[model samples]
Target: MSQPLTGVKVLDFSTLLPGPLCSLLLAEAGAEVIKFERPGQGDEMRSYEPKVDDDSANFVLLNRGKLSVAIDLKSPEALSQLLPLIREADVLIEQFRPGVMDRLGLGYAALAEVNPRLVYCSITGFGQHGPRASEAAHDLNYVAASGMLSLTAGNDGAPVLPPALIADIAGGTYPAMINILLALRQRDQTGRGVHLDVAMADNLFTFQYWGLGNGALGDWPAPASGLVTGGTPRYQVYRTADGAFLAAAPLEDKFWDNFVALVGQDANALAKMSPHRAIEAVAAAIALHPVAYWEDRFAGQDVCTSRVVSLEEARHEPHFQARGLFDRSVTTAAGGTLPALPVPVDAAFRRPDRSAASPALGAHNQLLNR
Candidate 1:
């Protein structure tokens, strides 16, 4: 089966999670992604912890199936070398702050002039023209600025750090991928490309649609008071006797009834209790059993209850293994194999072989001469 993006060419100039992850999705869908990195030092993510084959596991995981071309963009000869690649690329995605690309003379305007059908995407914290466009922020800051952090407050009323990079992946990567594909379709019709401004902070507002809708009405729910956020015992995490956590989200009445019966709680009492007391009641019941006990109790129960496994445990999960989620592996320079990180692309679109690995710095420097 031919992949959907088999003929598409992508030039990725982004670092860290958002842009690389976006390009990874594109690559998985069969785009020829060329990751442009700095001359000596590569993406900063290469230095992150939990190294594999002397490279950050994160870097290897996100950058597989992409070629690396190293160059000093600040040098006078940069444009002459890059223009050819830009001209051939169907898409160019970067994660620099506003005006940074313009300063380097690799801005969308310049690149688009050379390749009229290029879908130039710029991913930033705020946006190209926003008041905080130039502000420095990471995943946490972007989520905080988007009001998501306020909704994630713990019992002590302090915001808890999210377990995932929701802002980076959801805000930046997913939007960039969607918009770039949309732009490609548009280009097919008009024979002209578009410059996409993917603002991570701005995109996050959509995740609060329910809360925003409530605020627009006369009654505004306080942070952490929404039904999904912790306003009800049906949707919350409970600690097990073994100190592990169980994510209990039996929101529907049927599922909730099952959970109530299994935990030996009165359904009517739980349904009428204050949110605080309801949570306490669930917590108390859950604390009486170890995670393994609860796991056995809830197996095939349709109660929407599951153990909160660690990353290591998740890697070896039976369900995921049965689904063949980790069927592919990328080989390292030292001939070691690490599982290829899964992307959402359909199996028919994925590469049949997974020999593609994260490249060494300037590994494809010869491409510049060509």
Candidate 2:
């Protein structure tokens, strides 16, 4: 749909998950996001597992609504094309190590000379001038470095690896998108460009605001012993009889009462018991029912509970479909259709456009420089 950010051009000089995701958010909001990749391989994700020739599943999810413009940055002729385009761009996003962009002479300073109003953003594992700015790390490593790993664990169990990339998405992708949007707003008023140095590792700390707040207020060993971690039974996950799970996070007294009242859980589980025992009680109560039974009971209730859904099952979930979450079309290479995620916008305000399918490497070379 042609929504807000319509006609806004984004020069995406980023690759992999976080960078691509940042551009995807802009595209979803109706920007012309042109993705620049290495000359041949394009995004490394294009060849990541779950492939069909060049269409890797990971690539499709991240690269949707984006046009691929492959160019060799090391080549002067290829790099020169950015001069004209950056002049026209409203925003430019890139994910690279600190000095890499500077070496290519395509860094924020270089581009600002040609396009003063360009919003240049760089997403990195560390920020542009940090001690670890040039350190090599992936999502897992970023989380570990940020101390997020230390806080993840069951009672006396091993530290658990989260199923998703929180640092990359929550830290890198989310912040970069927001920074660009903020920069865009500022550019509208100030008519000046800005540089955003976003670090995925830094995001891990930000995502732990609740925990960090608790640590600041309550002090040390008691931090995880406070509101969010394993502190209250009202905010925890419990496994059901049939091996499914439900999340219950009713923080306020009224809501917590509603949660435990439904399952007849011990009242002491709420205010006084040690965190471990409190969680155990909640788990015990939830373990008595099949997920379907609780799913029915929790249906119209405000207990802060929901069934933990799988990726595949979630794709077919009726609630999302009812809410029109997947409202766009994804055309397969042979022209078949799959539901593409529409995005967050009011139906009346969102403009409809036939979004062209994502391109192969160097697919839109002729149009890239414009």
Candidate 3:
């Protein structure tokens, strides 16, 4: 496909979501992604939720547009084949624990000897230097440790995990992509590669911008109490008559006033009412109408109120569709096409980025030699 990364090569030693997802983006943009796997067992995500003929949708979705290389990292013959391939790689990403790669003699320092221009990326729970870097954790664990978990609430009224893999995919993928790009830019100037030690926990901490700021000011020390959290009634979710949902996030006074007016309530009273009372009023009023009734009433009002759409509904959202969010397609290893989600890129960045199919298991055994 036509893409800016057409000539780029990526060695992905990561499994599951984050690392796979990072390479998937590069591969989509025409980079040749080589996914390394164990001899028999592959990425655990292959059997995770939503199986289609024993292949996980999660795996299929993130792993398209890459080639797979399966070999036992412990085998001398396999190691031999891998070294030469590593020598020619532009970027190398690994999600193993801090010492795993080093034990296998495939660490950043060792690999860089063969390819001085290789960008080596290491993904872990905490970091290469932190005390908790050795701990084993999942998305929720990382979220909890990073303080982002306190920002979320559950139906049971306790801090809970978000439905998505926010820590792994968002934090890890964002760190990988951004640093890789930065390293690529630096390579142009220095003619050498760099190592990126991306701690998923630290990366996930970026979500706590306002809370962190609050802490620095010695105010709002409690989590979820800051302006951007659940502190303002203007930024809360209200229910509709049919038990559907509506969200109002107009933190500004003007939009908050408009939201109250749209609900046929006393705008001034709402602003003055106790948070509990105001939330109750908004909730009660919203329960008086079906989603459609309020949707029409609020239409063209430029209010921040909106229906809380589901994933399926979001897939068909007119706004996103019109904006070409999911406009492109990615070719699959099975010679098929699937919807490609458009990433946010600068409008001034004029580069052709396209999607290709994810690599099948061990699909590139012969293409890359060690």
Candidate 4:
């Protein structure tokens, strides 16, 4: 199979999650991603916990199939060495605060002068020029700023921390990848690159399209009061006898009826009860059975009810295995291997290799000497 990004070259200066993941997708599609890291420490994520050999598991996973070059950008001779690569690079990704790159003489304008067709992408928390651009924040702060956290409330009405870095991946990485592709497309026609400003917080509003619509009509949803949040009995979580939870989302009348029948509850009575009362009744009924019992009862039923499974359980699920989501693996130099982090790229667009290893720190620093 032919990968889409066969000859494309990427200069990855971003650390942590968003930019690294975006480039990982590109690398999977056959791009040559050359990562620039600080000489000694490399990307900060390399020091993160759960080491596989010398690098962190996260670093190993994200930097897979990429080349690494270690150099001190602050050194006077840095730009001279980078200019050769920059002049030929098709893309560059950075996640520094707005002016940090400019100060380091590696901003879009500086690099564009060298390679007019370079797709320079900057991923930031707020944005390049927003009021909060220079302010420090993380994934949680971005979601909170976007009002997404406000919708994720528990029974006590306090916002719960999200399980994953929603803002980092959903808001930053995906958008950066999309826009970089778009910018590359534009370059194909225009013969000139464009600066892409990807603000994680700004992009988060798209995830709240429904909430935005409600807010526009002055019917803004309060904490856990929205349909998908925790509003109706048809869309809530119920705990089982063994302290496990079931995610129930039989919203339509047909599915609700099926769920009611399967749970041995009166559909009409549930419809008559207050939303809170209905939720309580459903919870009480579910509490009568263990997760396995409910899982068996809901099997092959269109009630849209399922037990909340653990990560390990989900990874070992037969459906995902059948789909070959974990068929590919990331191997370490020491020969330890784990399932590659599943990416959104289609199978036809990805490399066919079943296993690949992430680069050791400065493993490809020889490229810089060229």
lDDT of each: 0.89, 0.79, 0.78, 0.92
Residues 107-142 of candidate 4: C-alpha lDDT, one tens digit per residue: 999888889999999999999996899999999999
lDDT of model 2 at residue 118?
A: 90
What CA RMSD would you report for each candidate? 1.6, 2.6, 2.6, 1.2
TM-score (C-alpha, index-matched) for candidate 2: 0.90
Model 1 Cα lDDT, one tens digit per residue, 1-370: 7788999999999999999999999998989999988877789998899888767888888988888888888999999998888888899999998999999999988877899999999999899996898999999999999888998887789988899999899999999999999999999999999999999999999998988898899656565578888888988989999899999999999999999999999988876888889889989999998999999999999899888878889989999999888988876556667889988877888877756777777777787787
Predicted model with the maximum TM-score: 4
TM-score of each: 0.95, 0.90, 0.91, 0.97
How many collisions per candidate? 0, 1, 11, 0
**How much does candidate 4 score in TM-score?**
0.97
Best candidate, lDDT: 4
Against the true structure, candidate 1 reaches a TM-score of 0.95
Preferred candidate (lDDT higher): 3 or 4:
4
lDDT of 1 at 120: 96
Model 1, residue 35: displacement in angstroms? 1.4
Question: For residues 57-104, could you state the per-residue lDDT of candidate 3 as single tens digits?
Answer: 677778765688888888867667787778778999999988988888
Question: After best superposition, candidate 3 residue 170: deviation in angstroms?
Answer: 2.2
Evaluated against the true structure, the overall lDDT of model 2 is: 0.79
Residue 265, candidate 2: how far off, in angstroms? 3.4
Q: In candidate 2, residue 195 scores what lDDT?
A: 94
Worst 10 contiguous positions by lDDT, candidate 2:
347-356
